[model samples]
Target: MTNQGFPRGLRILTAGEYRHVFEHASFRIHGKGLLALATPNDLGHVRVGLVFSKKNVRRAVDRNRLKRLTRESVRLRQQWLPSVDIVVLSRKGVHEIDSETLARQLHGMWRRLEKDVKRQPEHQQ
Candidate 1:
């Protein structure tokens, strides 16, 4: 459970992984394109996943940009986050919003999510 670099081996991408996060994880919506879900992982660092579906955003460039912004937002705030599996999903509105606004919304969302996570009972291994 070492804290590997972001996007190296720390993202939840598989179907099974998303299923587990949705079923067992706790989440909060931060903004139109920003949602955060947290699940207990044996790994001792926060792992992030970005979901920018083609259905939500048609262009590959837009999708990649959104994912990049999401990743950067999380990375910049990594120090404040707990060690958990975190997933960030992008909605249609994400493409229309500017990066500064998105980042601010993400920060606010993370803060609220952090509070909620702290209130949950510790996960059983």
Candidate 2:
């Protein structure tokens, strides 16, 4: 079994990584101001990346809050995720939602993606 612990390895760190997910995403979900895009990886553990644009939130404090919320949620649930690279993008109005609501929406998106990825054919990967 793969290491379920989320260390540095379980993260999309490079520009190319972000590009790969964007170019070859097999699963995608949009929720409120958040958009999650994912593609299967050969690695045995899931990895995630986040993108919060200033144009969307228009405030550094709100953008940081979104990132913090996202990382916390992903960190808690990452062990159950499939081997995939995921990128999260924020749109306008993300900061308006409360953290609990934001979390609920994010979790729902993850659940949908989990099901979608499982149903995809190997060729899609």
Q: Distance from true position, residue 39, model 2, in Å? A: 0.6
Tens digits of per-residue lDDT for model 2, 1-125:
64435578878999999999999987888899889999899998789999998888888999998988887777788877778999999988889999999999989988988888889887867
Best of the candidates, lDDT: 2
Q: How far off is residue 110 in model 1, in Å?
A: 1.3
Tens digit of per-residue lDDT, candidate 1, span 2-110: 4425766567768887788778776655577656777877777677877888988888998888888778877777767777787787777678888788778888887
Q: Who wins the TM-score comparison?
A: 2
Model 1, runs deviating above 4 Å: 1-7, 123-125
Tell me the TM-score of each prediction against the true structure: 0.82, 0.92
Model 1 poorest 10 in a row by lDDT: 1-10
Query: What's model 1's lDDT at 24?
Result: 78
lDDT of 2 at 30: 88
